[model samples]
Every structure is written in structure tokens, then in C-alpha cells.
Target: MSVNEIDEQGLGPQARRSEATKRALLDAALADMEATGEASIRITKILQESGVTNGSLYHHFGSREGLVQAAIAERFLGSVTKGLAVFAHRVGEVGSTEQLFEVFRDELVRIGSPDVQTQRIHRMTALAAALPRADLLERIIADQGRYFDGAADSLARLQEHGFIRFDVDVRAFAAWFLGLSLSRLLSDIDPQLNPDNEWSEYTFRALVAILTPAPSAH
Candidate 1:
């Protein structure tokens, strides 16, 4: 596949789906979690669904919990990478920090799959549980940061072009932009407070108006 095609898909074809056995296991775990919720997920069920051996699971993921962590981490980063693909695609289109906000908004919409609500819950749960698991924390955070940095690179370009006004730190803007999109977890806290349409419209306009023109000099 073309480079963009690979990236647009998920973490590149190699990491995403190249490992037939490991991917099968991860996919089975995700499917199981989605169908019955994490409470009902069982290792036997995952093994049976994936047709991967116990030894293979242990070798690849270390244990049942390890498999679960890997599954959640992969799913979470997959959503992130999907959104980054959009920003990467639109890198040339950005003309302002406001446009970068539109990119952030678009990234959220891109990641907002029908199951995004479920995925958000799963992501939050995994992170909470990961607090005690250093290995899993490293994997999840590293994967997530990798993509955010990729998006930040795009913002840096816009700043160079005078679209994103000077003096506005691109890294700060990038991180804030990502956090706002990743706020699905917070949004899910209360239905009444989680109006996507109103929130989206407001952020788009707010972001544009927040920009100040570059200073002129004689």
C-alpha cells in the first residue's frame, strides 16, 4: 500500500494487521469486550475466538491481563492514528491556527466512529487500570504521544507559513487541540452537558476568533 494509505488505515499496515496471530488475538479481545463489556471477557473466549494458542498468547502478550492491556492500548491508539491521518492529509490545507482548530475538530469527527462512545469508556478504563502497570502505561502513552507529535509537526508548518501567528506556541496549541478532541471521556460524564453539535460549532468559531494577526513593521 502507499505510505498515506498505510498511515490512514491504522498505525501502518505492519503494526496494525501484519501479525496475523497477534492481530487475531487482539481483535478477538476487542470484539469480546465490545459485545459483553470487560466484565464478561474471558481468556478462554478470546483464545477460542482467535484460534491462537495459549503459548502464543503468553509469548506475545505475557498473560491474559497483558493481552487485555495490549488490546485496549491498540484500540485507543488506532482511533488516535485514524484522526492523525486526517491532519496529515490536510497539512497542506492549513492556513491559520483557526484552520488548525478546524483540523482538531475534524480529527474528533474522524475518530467519532459509531462505537466511539464504547471505545472512550474502554480507553478510560484501561488508563485507570494502567496506573499500576508500568509496561502498559509506557505502551499506551508512547503510542498516543507518537501521533500527537505527528499532528504537531503539521502545526509547525502552518506557523512557518504565517498562518498560525507567531508567538503562539505550536506545541501548546497542538496539545490543547488534541486534549479538546480527546475530551470524549469528560463529555460522557453527563448527557445534558455533552452536546456534540453545540460544542463543535462553538469551538470552531471560538478558535478562529482567538487568533491575533501577525504584527506589522515599517
Candidate 2:
């Protein structure tokens, strides 16, 4: 069952209300970060925007840093995971390597698009913030493991159908794909350096080469 279902089934009225307040505070925190374009949010502003009490914030999150971490996990990372799920579902429907390549090519374009770039920036900012906090970093690592595992499962299905090389590790390939996509951040900082077409073609070629099965000797 989903988190929301559990919340509804298990929580008392007061507990549900508290959860609502927590949600409000998290929403306010994320909104403030997005508006300011900064990962470090002001607790006072969040409390004001959320109409949640300072004591309540401390009671729920323990500290401002805790609130920020939770916000990043729930909003920024959550968005990335949701997008991955959709992409994985699309991958599962592909009937051939050519169709899979088309799916990936479209994904490459989508990832470098302005909207996805903004999302990537937000997620990277969250990761940067989490780097200094061991607990947050651990949480992020665990989340990423699950995300990559789901992606690997999708790729495994393609492998079973002879659409991908049997020798390749799908989990590692998933991680590599993520790294390649995130590397666009280097170009993102420069306005004059749009290497979308070149990057996509090169990466797609590499992907095809890596996934194509070797010929068997007669």
C-alpha cells in the first residue's frame, strides 16, 4: 500500500491533522526554495507562509535543517522518482531494440529540455545540501538504490527478450545513464554552449554499442 493509504488507514484524527500540518510546512518550504532559487531556506519565512507554529515545526521536524531535508526528499527526489517510473513503464512496452532506442532518444531530448533542466538543477541542489548531513545522505542513497533497482528490472525485461546484451549489468547501466544525464549540468551553466544534438547522438551511439549483443560463432 502507498504512504497515503497507510496514513488514512492507520492515523487518528489528531494524527491526520498533524500530518496535514507537516505537509503544509513542507509545501511552504519547497515553495520558498523554488522562489528564491536556493536550497537554504529561511525557517521564519516557511512558518509564516505555512501558518504553522514555530513550536509545531520543531516538534515535527526537530530543526530547520530537518525540515529542509524532508522537503528535499518529499518534493525534489519524489519528482525524480515519479519521472523514472514513467520512463521505466515506457521501456517495458518496447518490442525491439530500435523502439527502445527511439524511447531513449526521446528521453535524451526531454532530459535536456528547459523544464527538465530546471528539475535537474533543483535535485542537484538537494544532493549538495544533503552531502554534509550523514542521515540525509544515507536516506538519499537508499532512495537511489530503489530507483536504480526498478530501472534495472525494466532493462532486465528487455534483456530477456534479446533486446539488450546479456553480459551487461542493468543496475550499473542505469547508474551510468543517470550520471550521463546529470553531466549536462556542466553545459547548463553556459548559455552559448548548447551541445544537445551532439551529446545525444554520441551518447545514443555509445548506448547502442554497449547494449548490442555479440555475434555467436557458428
Which number leads on TM-score? 2
> TM-score for model 2?
0.89
Candidate 2, residue 155: Cα displacement in angstroms equals 0.4
Error of 2 at 169 (Å): 0.4
Kindly provide the TM-score of model 1 when superposed on the true structure, using C-alpha atoms. Answer: 0.76
After best superposition, candidate 1 residue 106: deviation in angstroms?
A: 4.6
Question: Which lDDT values do the candidates have, in the order given?
Answer: 0.72, 0.84
Candidate 2, residue 76: the lDDT equals 54
Q: Which model scores highest in lDDT?
A: 2
What lDDT score is found at residue 21 in candidate 2?
96
